[model samples]
Target: MSRGDAHAAVRRRVCLSAAVAWLALEALPARSATTQDATWPEEPDPAPGRGTPADQAPIDWPEIGLLDGRRRAPQSWAGAPVLVVFWATWCPYCLRHNQRVERLFREVDPARLQVLGVAVDRDERRVRDHLRQQGLTFPNTVDDGGLRARFTERRVLPMTCLVNAQGRVSLRIPGEMSADDVRALAARALAG
Candidate 1:
């Protein structure tokens, strides 16, 4: 083949190879960094005022000490729907969501529902002060990665989950929510 013709053929071959590679990458299913088979499952497009169903496997809750010097055991609130919230002090979304959660805690009976807050922040004093200032009496514990891993791998702030009376996680929400939505969580848990 002529020199120019040979060069042109090589260029075309390279372009075709690049196109094939691009197509292969584009055809692959998109994988999120937060997804894990062992962790809680997620919905493609979660509906407003609703939470997606999480893993059916029952959660093995460890004995956790509340910031208020109280200790909570699984048997203490057995056969009750438990609301577990993973939050942080600096997260603005968590701040607002926590207030609505506090209201829900007060409105619902302890026998019907149990609320537990998991603060991912290292500052125990700040978390305690924030809860105290908000007049939130719900039991909360500061996590050093141990407790958080049992629930979710997503680092999203204000992650919430509803563990049913049987200790199975029923609903898993990964972001902030409205007051009405928080109120409906109890109804959803009881309805099942």
Candidate 2:
């Protein structure tokens, strides 16, 4: 090959190699600063008018259906702290957030704190399956229209709200949060 042709070939090979490396890195589950620093969009607070439902104390657990064929009745866990996660089965961000929350859930004292994952989708089976796939055993409840409508229906999935022991919102994270944030919220929840 001519000298010019050889140099051009070497340049092409280097470009191809670089492209392959970039694709391989993208395919991996990224745990770098870019992924860690990146976060889902969030709101300072949940949607307005989600103020306590009539005859319901603000921040109290509303009646919702649990995954295990059981029901979560209001006031049953009244005095405990609830980390309410409003998520959907179809959201990839929700999947990632829940996996982290599940780790936090396992670490915390369930007796003093609770993680209530409220699935916004109508498909109960999908929610259950997703939770199972994530290996999350924390109590998950699929929101039956009324509960979700009363909460934020602004289309942002994976919203988190920390309701303290006295049935009031202490922290409102409308999108994805770090595991450290979840742990800090747990500490605040338990302190109340």
Candidate 3:
């Protein structure tokens, strides 16, 4: 073969090898740069100035402040699985995801799980009204942005993570997932 043709073949082989390597990297399970514990007291410390509300839930646990002047911490649900979703009112994916989540919430056994919705949007009124118009009965809170940023990876919307009963983050998902998918994820989270 001509030298030019040989060089072209070499380049093609190199490109193919690089593409394969990239795909292999992508297929691996994603672990956070900051490792999350799989199971109490081992949970990451609360981000400073989290702006959790004063009238927190009566449950004795870590207080994750809410929008309605209340807070529900992971500890509050002590021994029960906790699902926390970091969402925004304007995110279209979040709107659809919430609908699926509503169904999951209804079908799931509350004694085995707890869900926390954190709205990172600044306008509490808009967030509250939007959720109401959508008939979302699950409790949600408006974060001052700190808590959301802390847990968010890629700063994406509809990030969902599950803290197992032991206060460890069993799953940290960042993107929209179907109701069935979330249920499957939750099943694993709660089984802890």
Look at candidate 2 and give me any clashing residue pairs: none
Ranking by TM-score: 2, 1, 3
Candidate 1 residue-wise lDDT, 1-192, digit = tens: 999999999999999999999999999998644222223344522434433444345677788888989888757757888999999989888888899899888888888888899999999998888888878888899999988776666788888888888887676777887776787776777665
What ranges in model 2 sit over 4 Å off?
1-57
RMSD, one per candidate, in order: 11.0, 5.7, 8.4
Selected candidate, larger TM-score, 2 vs 3: 2
For candidate 3, lDDT tens digit of each residue in 44-154?
Answer: 324454322222222233466665667664456777877888889899889988887888788778778887788888888999899889888777888776665545334
Which of the two candidates, 2 or 3, achieves a greater lDDT against the reference? 2
Q: List TM-scores for all candidates, in order.
A: 0.70, 0.71, 0.63
lDDT per residue, candidate 2, 30-141, as tens digits?
Answer: 5643133323233334445454322234653566668988887887667787888888888887888888889888888877997888888888888788888879887888
lDDT of candidate 3 vs native?
0.70
Better structure of 1 and 3 per lDDT: 1
Model 1: how far is 170 from its true place, Å?
Answer: 1.0
Angstrom error of the Cα, residue 174, model 2: value is 2.1
Tally clashes: model 2: 0
